[model samples]
Target: MTRPIAKPANVKARTRRRQVSPSLLRAALVLALAASCAFAVPVVLGALRPAQSADGAGLPPVQVALSGLAAGACMSLSPSGSNAGKTVFIDPGHGGMDPGVVGTVGGRQVLEKEVTLGVGTRLAELLRADGYRVVLSRMADSSVTKLSATDSVAGAMTASAVHRDLVTRTLCANSVDASVLVSLHFDAFDDPAVGGTETFYDAARKFAAENKRLAVDLQ
Candidate 1:
């Protein structure tokens, strides 16, 4: 028609423009496939996942053994050598105002609370041997120990004010920014003949791997 005016773009340019359409179509197809695959990925992964039991496989059970270490309220780690870096809190169950369970034998009578402090003291000595800094909730069994017990509140209190005071002292002394408090308590029962040893710790709370190891060692 009117010689098509003198075309600015020649046949080659027109051919190139036609080629571009296919490339754009291919790109669009690829993006669509990618989007569909993205949606399918999670579902496919979920389906391939293994089924799990409500109760998972448990860790191997452990038995504690303390052969060489001494026994008291609890044996302490050496605070001067291997124990130098650690701060250990040792609490002797009952003292002073609280003379825990009284034992009756044929002719001998033993006091639970008094005996615990004796053992705890011996234990602390052993811990000091290894290099650990040791602190006792109470230094002795007397009126002063009772004073620490009743120093807090009014006369109205729990079973053993002395025991409560010892715990208070331990928590107070060990509350340093990062410290481990090990409260030592002896077992008491209706029967005087029943006796055995037990140890406890919170490995999670105190970063207390060392304490646990010590306990195992002393067991």
Candidate 2:
């Protein structure tokens, strides 16, 4: 006979965090970046714009001003149209069996996968039109890696399958010798009022400084 493991304390009282999914914040960021690409300019010089909350209310002016200041620091990085010779890798987060955070808009259900794919695809198109070679992790509503029969268990993605899929995205970027890799994701909280742009970078990576600088510019 085996004993059942006890659940963590306060599990019932804690507010559940919805899985991070694409939101208005991400859509704003991606569209802004895409517009920069359309101008054939380095992304740092792009203008920053205010994003709306979940309820379509505008963000505070202070947040927009701060983002502008962060972007200003990128002016020293590159000259105009430097991206023409670069290869960019765009990874649209979550797909296939993973719907990520399911939220509602206009009283209708919206899937994170759909939002991410739309944003990523548009970004790729704009970059390509500006003479940058772009590679996407997945071009459709499917897994980045070839799905194995055992990839899913009990209607959820298996741990190994998740790992394999993520690894494959990195491998795809590496294969193309990508100049910049942009993995897009949106955030969510239990509170429906939350909404804002976010950018993340690995501080421990060798290119940490560069990554951080780019993140700051994007944010």
Candidate 3:
């Protein structure tokens, strides 16, 4: 066979240089990938996380803020002799299965439960703003009583469901040692013509005078 022509000197020199090993190449690629991931992870996580205030504080949920005003926990508006020491219990009448009244306005349903709850919630907010502690009998359209398995069972256990609900509301007010118990309800009359705000208090209550004054103020 004829002898092969001699390769170019530059090509021979390049061929003689040490080639990069496959293992080293793979290790370099892995290191590059790891570095990219290390830089990207915290950025992705921070974007996905809930936003914090500039001071790194997170806000309380609305429900928690509304329901947090228990006895002795109210933030006082004044340094001394504020309404902070007083707790008020608000009862939104007829929740759950007990819709107190039903009316139609402009072809839309007007539920007393919803109305009472709305009023109670607004009143609670107002009172809390005035530095008073507030507790609601039912925070939403739900029963305040921790009842039995069934309505009948609950009724049997506590005489009647209506009575049980009333008792539960009273107990809640007492438990919180509320300065005042405001039971909110919408009135319905047989004669649609008669409509006005009316407030009543138990005549036998020891603080009947104070109750009357409260009723008058409310009216």
- Single out the weakest 10-residue window by summed lDDT for candidate 3: 29-38
Tell me how many residue pairs clash in candidate 1.
21
Cand. 1 Cα-lDDT: 0.38
Instruction: Give candidate 1's error at residue 13 in angstroms.
Output: 92
Worst 10 residues of 1 by lDDT: 29-38
RMSD of each: 34.6, 15.8, 35.1
- Please list the residue runs of candidate 2 whose C-alpha ends up more than 4 Å from where it truly belongs after superposition: 1-83
Flag regions of model 1 displaced more than 4 Å: 1-83, 142-167, 176-179, 191-194, 202-218
Give the per-residue lDDT of model 2 (tens digit) for 92-137: 7777887766666665777767888898877766665565655577
Tens digit of per-residue lDDT, candidate 3, span 1-219: 111111232111111111333222211010000000001112222222222222212222121122323222211111112345565667777776666566555556666678888887777767765656565777766666654566545333334766777766665565544567777876444333334454545445556566656655665
- Which regions of candidate 3 fall more than 4 Å away from where they truly are? 1-83, 152-159
Each model's TM-score, in the order given?
0.47, 0.63, 0.60
Residue 120, candidate 2: alpha-carbon lDDT: 83
Report the error of model 1 at residue 162, Å.
5.4
Residue 58, candidate 3: how far off, in angstroms? 9.8
* Candidate order, lDDT descending: 2, 3, 1
